[model samples]
Target: MKIKDYAILISVIMIIVMMVIPLPPLLLDILIMINLSIALTIILVAMNTREALEFSIFPTLLLLTTLFRLGLNVSTTRSILTNQTGGEVIETFGSFVVGGSAIIGILVFLILVIIQFLVITKGSERVAEVAARFTLDSMPGKQMSIDADLGAGMISDMEAKKRREKVSQEADFYGAMDGASKFVKGDAIAGIIITIINIIGGLLIGILVHGMPFGEAAQLFTLLSIGDGLVSQIPALLISTAAGIVVTRAVSEGNLGTDITKQLFAYPKLLYIVAGTLSLIAVFTPINPMLVLPVAGLVAYGGFTMQRNLNKEEKLEKEASAKSPELDSIKSPESVIDLLHVDAIEFEFGYGLIPIADKNQGGDLLDRVIMIRRQCAIELGIVVPVIRIRDNIQLQPNEYVIKIKGNRVASGEIMLNHYLAMSPGIDDDSIEGIPTIEPAFGMPALWVNEDMKEEAEMSGYAIIDPPSVVSTHLTEVIKRHAHELIGRQEVRALIENIRETSPAVVEELIPNQLAIGDVQKVLMKLLKEKVSIRNLLAILETLADFSSQTKDPDLLTEYVRQALSRQITLQYAQPNQALQVITAGASLEKKFAESVHRTEQGTYLSIDPETSQLIFQSISEQASQMQRTGIQPILLASPGTRMYMRQFIERFSPELPVLSYNELEPEIEIQSVGIVNISSGAVNMS
Candidate 1:
């Protein structure tokens, strides 16, 4: 018998035995801790070791459990002492003293609970970080990939990066001094006010509930009754449960605040069951010998079920979905880039000094602009060129003082001609008599803005679309024509012309500095700008899998380039032949199975065909050794691998059935994969 079979069998028996045994109090406590820890670990494993597992609630729950036990002890002792002292004992304390003290204790506890809850809620993220750090500490030589999930896009990398940057900024000397001043002047006052409120509330509750005079008939508040007992506790019970649910939901959403309210509304039955069970235990368990187990079980089951439904699965899925966008950013298969084709390179920097010809301004820095244009080349499924631009300066209307910079090969007016010439089927004749030419091209002209016909005469530039149409409509018409009639080279030339003169950079930087949300927008724009060859291949693989399969390499390449040009999120990698080769091992196993099914005339164990060959191979050598010793042989196989072992042993005799691992003598054992710590020792039942 294989060792794995014995391990499984023994583990099952031990669990059954443990469940049935009446454990001592110390052992019961140990078991409780172990069981809860195991349950937590199982939930963490299912959630794939993500950040949510590090949330503060786990430790809070453990602390609550300890406090609940302490509360139980306090309740028991109070009950016993009060019973002994009797009604006369309170009378001896002059009524006022006992009432005031009871109120004080209750008020104190309430204040503590509220303060702790607030502190936890406020510092929950920090707590999660600490939890993650503690969890990793136990595993030596193992480091978690800190940004693995962010890199995968469950959370935005750009968002995390921005947060870190903000922290760094705040850590600077000036920022630190400003923060400390604010904290002392502002937060210190707020905290002091809260503390004062807590003390006043505690004192008021103490005086009203205890020290204040009351008749004998009104003395019922001191004892357990509907108003002062479980009924009063119900609100807190409901609130805490709702808080748990809300916190789980919000944490999953990467938000602050608990989603407890939602869970309370969702599972009315669970709250009822838990409340009823807890009430029953508090009221009756102390007096009953046999009710303990059932109550404990009910409470445990309620907690388990509540967490399972509301806290774990849905939360994990939300966290995982958050990562999809990062994955989407991979370059697609249709992007192509050819660096050898050289042309004008447009560099962008600063803004406003340059009036954008229209709203389609290329507002970005030179480095960023280059990267995005590169990405565009990869997306378009065509060869991209190394563009160089010069004499690129933005000017106000009617300004003829063009400060053309390095390598000023052409004037801004000349650049405008190259741009207009990129339309599919137009030429110099098409724009010959436009009115507002020179000023439209940011040049000195008296007739500019009077009409295209007037400007064309003044500056030699013309409006391809009629003046009655909106500028956007005209640009779209021009773009459509350029896309269809002009080839990539002409389009590249046109883009270069625009890059040399168009104010694209100013368009990008303004919005990002305005709000927190714009950070994501800016980041996405950056990612889409730069298309790399490696990224394009990754996108193609996904597309090929989900959409249509492609065989034409040229078409594939061109499509990738176009996609990159469009700035869509995608990733691609070249086809992997080696991976295909590795997958062939499955086919080899199939061949082996065929060979066994057709076997003939072999004396083997009377086993199923599936396991016959496995058993034959395993025991053949042992059988041969036994024959030389003039003795029979017995072979054991582990439970899960039994089929394989049975087939291996079949080469010997058909009469012998393979023994299972557990059925063998205690001293006999064999190592098995995916199992731990099996030994040739006596099996100990729970």
Candidate 2:
């Protein structure tokens, strides 16, 4: 242990020894002085602390100090009764401090005991108990707040951990103080008892055994006992007051002295009023003017000085405000640089829709955004950046807009008091409501009031609340643009996350075989086609294998998709059911193969505009025919033509799923509901 650790151990041992061993008067005097000094130090330290936790060890220190005081009392009581004197300190306190009167000495001691026991000790104990209880009660709330901040990305894991630890430490500190305060109360009671015992025992020993008269014995022992009590109780009082200060200390930016001066003298006008009252009392009342007038003058002078200083400060503030340095900074070039940065995703709503995102007004949109980020991470294997939600005054009251990379991608309107009811494939004529389109799916929906909600539900219309409507629209917008959100930084984060468990695959695939941009491009391609990259290990492993052969992201993505065929198959194919799809005939595949022109930058399809028009017309007819049958149209093409086919088809039908033959599992039976051929210009069902 260090020297300070050993010193504390030795001090505790000496306190125990002071109780049992007989000490010389000189040693007792030194110990008493040491006790007084320590008590003074403790209260000073307590007053200087800005928060209770700053003095966390105070509870344990209080126990030790109380024990040391009691030990000093025991030694002094023994010395007073046996030797007819305690020490020079006690004798001086008895004779000079109390004016050599035993009655006055005893009365003073009792008053000190009353003050410590009835006032400081009792208040400190109660405050400690209440603080401990409240601290414990608030622990769960503090923990939950930390967790919420963590989920919202407002704080990192290390910051959250630190906050949680601080909360726990606060609870423990208060609880220890609660128990330690009982020590102060018990010490006060013990001081009173020990003083009484010393007086009774000293009187008996002096009169009966030392051949002294009753008056002399009473005078001698009573004075010594009172002195002993005074000597011990003074220090005890200081320590108890210190305990009160520590337990009642609240979190503040300043110490007790600073806060007291700053807050107590906060208003110089109040000082002037006090001074005026004092002057009136001195002038009109029977009070002595000579005694009160001078004090009143001092108070009035203080008020005037303070008021003058406050005016000077106010003038300086006004001058600073007129200068408006903040406006100057805003007009600076550096401030304009900040405006160049843009958020990855921004959700802006009109002022009337503030409650949709404000938790105080019963809005859960912020919570829903947290869930959206998590959902994206789990389903798309990419961490979605924090969605910035703010109110825009320029928009209509009910309109909200969703932005990706500073560009508005989607917008919708919400009625606060109405529920959106979408028709179940057929419009209900009986349902009377304002017609609207569901922002999430663009399906025909109605804004029905609370009165019509039940009828709409009974009519088999899907009922969604306004918040849900906004959240659903926001969620779809994020999913649709998930690819655009995953940049190189986000890809690096994913790589680091996977590196913890699959370091080999990550190290081999990233930078060594392909750059983060390359990996990001592959992931983006997968997300664009609505593929789940949750099984990132498989994706990374596929990239590692084929990246050496080709640096092309498109080719690498195809390889990854083929490796994730089982996932793709499970996503679209139903159990024990044949996967129905629109197939591209041999003629179209051959045409795409011939039209593919290769260059250094990669292959491109250079089909003539006539053939392109025919392809689009034929594909649209087949897709429309399949849609009429209530089936999602998926165009199945050979591996070589699938990427080009998807790239070509996305211009008109971005939502359509274009799957390659190798992207499907071999066990899945393919049933062609329609075929796209160049000559037919329409689907031929077979």
Candidate 3:
């Protein structure tokens, strides 16, 4: 373990020891929870970092406080009941009034929800990031090892501030504070509300069911006891949790996707509703109904306030609609059509320069091309490319070795032999008695010596050995096929070169960045053909070093190249290119546009029948595409574009379909895309 981890472990152990032994009962409850929390924090830090732990502290502290109070009540009441007259009665009374078991049960539930929140939100994000990063490593020049040592925790506000101070000289601290305030205040307030509601509900449940108004629940409900008491509360706990989820879904209405329980309780309405119901139950179940009556009133007050605020918002929206009708120019249907437009564009292949090291570089040319084509089709709107593989021979290291094990004959007789034994059938001019070769009846013939014929037949050996020239030719062909099938260094070098030059080139060469050898094909295409701005930027970086070495250019030219490289690098650096483009385009249009015009008169405030009809058609088309491919369409267009779009649809011979941006519905049933407010004027999109 690292020294830091060791220190934390030691400190937590010391704290746990103190908590178990000498601390007062009340303090012990607090210290025990704290100790447990510290242990948990350590595990989290080891697995993640400080940022993740910071989010857990609020819920932990609130739970500990509840447990501490529960313990105090139990100890004091048990001491009083010890002196009572009836032993069993006093014992029962003590259990109900003095024990703090209820709070402990509540604490467990809180911890579970906290864990769910972190895992759901952070866990999902971490998985996706790791996948993308892994996929990226296989691409050309961008390949680099990611250090796993980085903590999983988000950077702390204080740490973020410090980093920002170092990074931004002209940026204002207030801006940083504004952003931090949103999270801290929002999370803290939400935590407090949730804790209060949970503790109150549990307290009420304890009073009503266990007859413990100020003390612990009866013996049956003491912490960790395995009986009906624990089992029955499980359903109640789940119901509360479920209610919280439903309430949060209705109220929050956004991506609180991390912890369902935490988000559910984040809204004051859920907590208030749960507390009110539990408090009312306590009154009827024999506890002093008056004690819960006030609590119920408080919960009711909060609920009423929330309802009033929502009503006010609704009224304000109505008034605003009346005042400026033109504001609601975009409609739901037209927006969907705009989204489809984004999905239909396709990109063509653009290759970069290939690094060649040998004449056999052409062997893998098709495989390389196919890889790039598929990637471009996916990443740059190009279609899948066709790929083929071929084989070629390569020279081996042992080409010069030679050995001879036969006799040569001249004039139909053996001229020389390494070893020989005289035979009655073997003539002096025909040692081994073999005719070398002769054309007889238009066919070649081979003869063996009469004396060696028996030995050759016994061994079943070939009468004539094969020609070296034919054997050599077959060997060369086999070697060429094997080398070609495996791919050669030339192909590898070319791919590597392309990868180093342009990341886009690398992206284009592989399907999901899996083709490591297609980088060369990408480079070749980029250098040979015309391409888009994105591809051009990719090639600029790929060719920088080559250009610098081969051509003596002015400083201005080099500076331009450097600028272009930075731009492309920045583009690739964005987390999601498509989303980035949409947002960036929206911002630019918002700045440039003044007003949106409409077809009908009266300031054309909302989606009228004409716009609505057009938008309906657009949304219908988009809905169809969404069914085919599960991708949600994101519509981004200027107010002017929305208007022109509507007009274009009306006049076009093919009956062009377009969705309007102004008429988006609040719920998913009506609209899936939000209306990006770009200008002040009316542009009817529906």
Candidate 4:
């Protein structure tokens, strides 16, 4: 083992040795000084530590110090009873510090024991008990919070592990302290008992064994015994005080000294009151003005200095506040760009529904927002901005709005203390309340009272609380606007992230074959169609493969989708189930391909309005049939027609998802649910 590792063990062994073996006065004196040094060092460390956990080893150190003191007491007792002297250490304390008065020396020792045992040690033990109990009781909750933070992406795995270890250590330290505090208490009792026994035993040994005169023997041993007790008790009191400091300290930015100065002198007016009180006592009381007047004058001077300093700080703060705006304007002129910047997504609630966002009222909308951004980044390749939330007093108490770029995309009102009740997406159940529509999907719902929540759930209706309703709506709004949130900055950040893993792909595609704006357009096109860009390297690699073929974003997006076909197929197709879809008949596909117009602007379908209307009407009929059969309404079209068909479908059934044939995986089951044939002028469902 290392020398430092054995140092504590060796010291502890020496303490045990001291209890059994007699020592010379010179050696005893050296050991006595060491005891005082350790005690002073511990107390100083306690004062300097910002919190108890910082000095987690203190409880074990307390036990060691107490044992060392008791052992010294035993050695001193032996020396005093066998010979007329305990040690140079005890004699020096008795003669020099206590002024050769045995009574005064004894009284000092007793006072130290009383303070250590009754006041400091007693309180320390009780606090340790409570702190240990509470710490253990709270361990599970603290662990869960750490897990929650780790899950929420607020902290990393290593950080969470460190925090959990620290919590376990805190619980261990406090529990050990609860028992270690007893060591100090027992030491105090032992000091008192040992002192009394030595006094009685010394008187008998001196007069009876040595045949010394009674007066001489009593005087000699009494001084030595009291001094010995004083030496041991002094160190005991120091450690007990240290124990108290460690147990009682709270976590703070600074140690005990800084906290005291800042908090005690926080109010200059309080000091002024003290100065006035001191002046009144000096003037009215029949005390010596010589003693009282100078003290009062000092107090008044201190108060005046504090008041002057406080005024200086206040004046400086005011001047800084007054000058900040002009200084900022001069350094950086006002620009419309700064004022025009807006939150990509914002959630605002009225005063009545403020509880849904307020943390103190058990709301978790803020945390939910963090989770939403994370989910979107995983599900759709987008770094959604931190959604800003605010209370809008002008809004109806129960109303909230979800806005994108300062435009309200959707809004709804909810009952403050009610739950949203709906049948499991079925229109059969007729449970009634205040009629409302689910904001996200526009499903029919009712606002039912809290007491009716259990009945609704029991009756097979889904029940959602007010906060969840708002959060669900917010989630959908961000998803729909995910494409808009990602711009050049977000795209650059994504590319930078990709560069870390796939630098060659990013280097090959940008600036050589295409610019960053073109790549951004491709990714935006994918996002607009609800494609996830989380696998950015794959997307970039696919873009790199095809950028030389075409600069058109719509075609590049199609190529990216062809590469991500497996993901797209699984997204709509259930596991091992037929991928039911409505197909654009050959005649319709032929017509769309024939009408496709190419220009420098972009490739677009140039079919006349009448032909476009006819195609959409057929697609709508097929979509209604798909919805009725509980099939996911997906349309299969040629890669050339898919982009234009998406635009066509959006004008009518905005939520209908469309994909090209290349976007489907080779192995997926293709069950044609219907056909869209404008020649037939009507759609048919299988």
Q: Per-residue lDDT for 587-660 in model 4, tens only?
A: 77777778878787767777677777777877888888878777778889988788888877877776788899
- lDDT measured at residue 672 in model 3 versus the true structure, 0 to 100: 35
**Per-model root-mean-square deviation over C-alphas:** 34.2, 5.7, 32.8, 7.8
* Candidate that scores best on TM-score: 2
**What is the full ranking by TM-score, best candidate first?**
2, 4, 1, 3
Error of 2 at 288 (Å): 1.6
lDDT of 1 by residue, 1-686 (tens): 78997985674555455444443434433433443454444343323322333332433333333333223223322332233211222222323333444354345434534443344333333333443344345323221232333322234434656544433332242222222222222322332343333334334443565463443222333322111222212223332332233223322432222333444446635655665666677677565635555675666666667667777768888887997665555543323344343333222212232332322454222233334333444443322223332222454222222111222222222122222212122234434332233312223222223334443544444333221111222222222222222343443433333344443522232232222122222222222222233342333332343224443332233334344432321121112311000011222233334444322443222334544343234335445554455443444334333333345434445333433333333332232211111112211111
Model 1, C-alpha of 567: deviation from truth (Å): 17
Which candidate do you rate higher for lDDT, 2 or 4?
2
Q: Rate the local accuracy (lDDT) of all candidates.
A: 0.34, 0.89, 0.34, 0.84
* Residues 38-150, model 3: lDDT tens digits: 43443333232222222323333323333332332333233222211112322332234335344554454345445433433233234334433443444332211111111
TM-score of each: 0.23, 0.77, 0.22, 0.66
lDDT of 2 by residue, 1-686 (tens): 99999998998998899789888888989989998999999999999999998998998988888888888988998888878889999999999999999989988998999999999989999999999999999999999888778767788656987899999999999999999999989988998888889888887888889989999999999888888888899999999999999888888999999999888878988988898899999999999999998998899899889889989999999999988888778689977888899999999999999988888999899998888777777777776787898999999999999999999999999999999999888888999999998999888889999999999999999999999999889889999999999888878877887898889998887778888988989999999998988898899999999998998888898999999999999988999999999898887888788888899888888877777777787788888887878888899999999998998899878988999999999999999987776644432333
Error of 3 at 532 (Å): 12
Q: After superposing candidate 2, which stretches have Cα over 4 Å from the reference?
A: 77-85, 140-160, 204-221, 325-331, 349-386, 390-398, 414-418, 432-436, 448-452, 486-686
Model 2 scores what on Cα lDDT? 0.89
